[model samples]
Target: MKTNYLALLSLISILPLYAQQVKFEDFFTDQTMRIDYHHIGDAKSELVTIDQIYGYGIWAGSLLHLIDNFNNGAYYYKIYDEATGALIFSKGFDSYFKEYQTSDAAINGIKKAYHESAIIPYPKNKIRFALEKRGKQNELNEIFNVLIDPADLYIIKEEAKDKDVTVIKALYNGDPHTKLDVVILGDGYTSSEKAKFEKDLKRFTDLFVSSEPYKSNKNDINIYGVFKPSEESGTDEPGAGIYKNTVLNTTFYSLGSERYLLTEDNKTMRNLAAFVPYDAIYIMVNSPRYGGGGIYNFYCTFVSDNQFSDYIFLHEFGHSFAGLADEYYTSDVAYNEFYPAGLEPVEPNITRLLDKNNLKWKNLIAPGIEIPTQWEKKDYDANDYIWLKERTAMNKNIANLKRNKAPKEQIDAAQIEYNNKDKAHSDAVDKYLKSSKYWDMVGAFEGAGYSAEGLYRPMLDCLMFSKGTKPLCKVCADHAAKIIKHYTE
Candidate 1:
């Protein structure tokens, strides 16, 4: 009886090891399968429908890590072997449709549609694909599922688009399968601006590799740039009544936020990106506007010429790559209840602090420090409130001036005045925050994720929380390092 019991325990220990030993060639091919679909719905209801499937470039994702263990993103997808019904692959990603659902238009029962694509390793046989979304209580519920056959006649297998597009190998470490691959695309650069695009790509790549956790793991990354010129020189500024014939159709004023820049042309972007192997996408606009946007595992965008361009690049990538939540609650955003009350956010940087003993980043908390570590919130908020109001009024005034076709000198002077004041305020705030007793500590700092209360950040100041060249907080850095390992190791 003792021998039998010991054997049963031994069997249990080996089960998980066997499950983790899923081979890549067992159920997948060497190519890529992209499932395109239309995500339709409003705030109350959502639906997804198949559009077209494409067979494209060689698979670039990690062959070892087929399953995503990170519980991130608003939506999740799973691929299963049809014959055995065993889960083979899965990933979590945020989509533009998910963000749009939180917009006022969706809240008012206005339905919209967004084209999205799911890229996976080509299957060796028939497979079942399923997509799940997070409910109000943070549980994933399956919303869409379909059976896909590898040999389907309707699958589009064609030549790669934009063969003539310039490809710049900004940084190459090794095989893409063994490294985290990042593809950078340019928009709104005219054909004559090819040199400028290359220069901009090099600058961004250097900055990316110089920043820590990426800086520490630079050898595990590969960066590529896909440059396709547009007929115009800059992206659209709808609030200022300016439009351009850009390649990606990127624009500012996304979801009514003046500085939020994003592109809805997912298909075109994907087509261009097919030229290379990538795990993440970044769009670099040719404009000088102070605008950019990022969605977890979806994409990130930033303008090329701006005083805060470097900060935006690093900050937005934190969201797109590491799933870090915004740590600032003072700024206005189009999202309504982005992080719902009474629930913990999936982002690693911010939490609801429901369980003090089991904090998301409990291991990193400072020794003997309080869980809800208090900071100079009242003093900061008082100044932030005044700055926020001034910023809104300044943006409105500039937009109106542009609409009225004000002289270039007049517009430039107004912008200069505002920029000067903005710099002063930012400098003062940074100095004040650095003087805090908890500035160098790792503890739950209140006021994060668009909530002035409840949601707590991992630090007092980080790239996610402010407009500076600050490194990611310790919690965010650890999460990012894990993601890097997921791709490379």
Candidate 2:
């Protein structure tokens, strides 16, 4: 075969720093190689060991844009064309393993291992796969690197498991390779609840597509429902004294945070997801409780029947899909200062404002807008603290009641009071913030990335900032649009 290194180099010369420099066909096959591994760590250390490598259906990601230039994850993995020393494919991602290290257990010196996986377009020849993680300074540091040979006899060639899996196309507009492929899996729905799962999938997808970037990019997206019915009908709620034999092993009270729902069974989740082509995973648990979680490029989980399912589904997807950081800081979270002080965050929405000389999104900043813009932060923070404090106490009481086997009436009453208090405080802030003067201003607003004092967001009220009645801020929309294009463009 002939080569065109000069032309290819010239083609990518004007491209972004992380853009793929090699032809997709020159190095990759149509299939995907899923590298499953165990990521083990404590507060101060981490390690990853290969579990198995399997052929996961077709490659659903962009064939034209093989390299990821987005750079929006706590951890990143890149595949190199060893013969030519050129980058072929890469992706930025966050994992439950990394998030787990921030928990009280790990911080207190408890060690644990998490099951995880990363998939890439299958390569034709030997290639080098390097896994890199961000440090406290938020710099990309290579932690693990290995050479993968396609002809190795040890490479597993198993078919997609769960052949009985019933998949329905929820949103199909284009080819998998040319469009964003999203797979929605049901965690605790049983055979009897398959219809409900389908219905919820439609509802979830409808709301998701109605959002900013997704609303405009509907034609370039494909959504599917992969139903692996559980024996029971709801996820395990450890704090609520309820447990179920769910298919994906999802549970609430992750890291002692009541609402941080997650699943530790990555192997099973990936196996179920293997039933279809997927660029991202959205696991909807069959429950009415208010809880969910998202890990970048890994998966996002939401409780399907909750009152706030729609909002949470989209919010968590922002984290898992586009790597949007949480702009709200009042609520309790597992991590301590997840965003570092000096370095810039990889997410598009939040900024540390350390480099006033070079704003990350200075081009989008409207003229005359202050860099560290002002808002009703004192008022916003005041109401937010009241709401969060009450909510925390409410959750704590409910958990205790459940543990004591208190009457169902008592539990319902506690939730009702909390809900009423939540509604009143939310209404007060929303009314004040929604006033014409403060809305839609795109600048650096103090209080974001889990810190009310240090971090600055691009807008006053955003999907990341608060659950207010506003679409994504302009900054968020731009970042999300780029992510959508990364898959479909």
Write down the TM-score of every candidate: 0.96, 0.94
Give candidate 1's error at residue 457 in angstroms.
Answer: 0.2
Best by lDDT: 1
Q: Model 2, range 231-295, lDDT digits (tens) per residue?
A: 99898889878899989999998887889999999989988888888999999999877889988
The prediction achieving the highest TM-score against the true structure is: 1
Location of the lowest summed lDDT over 10 successive residues in candidate 1: 1-10
Shift in Å, residue 285, candidate 2: 0.7
lDDT of 1 by residue, 1-489 (tens): 435533543463355454367799999998999999999999998999999999988898999998887989999887867676667788999999999999999999999999998999999999878898998888888798898999999999875766559988999998988899999999999989999999999999999999989999999999999999899999988999988999999999999999999999999999988889999999999987788999888899999998889999999999999888999999999999899889999988999999988999998999988889988899999999999999999988898899899999999998998888887888888899999999879999999999998899999999899996678889989999999999998
CA lDDT, candidate 1, residue 233: 95
Candidate 2: where are CA atoms >4 Å away? 1-19, 161-163
The lDDT for every candidate, in the order shown, is 0.90, 0.83
Model 1 regions lying over 4 Å from their true place: 1-19
Q: What's each prediction's clash count?
A: 0, 0
Error of 2 at 8 (Å): 17
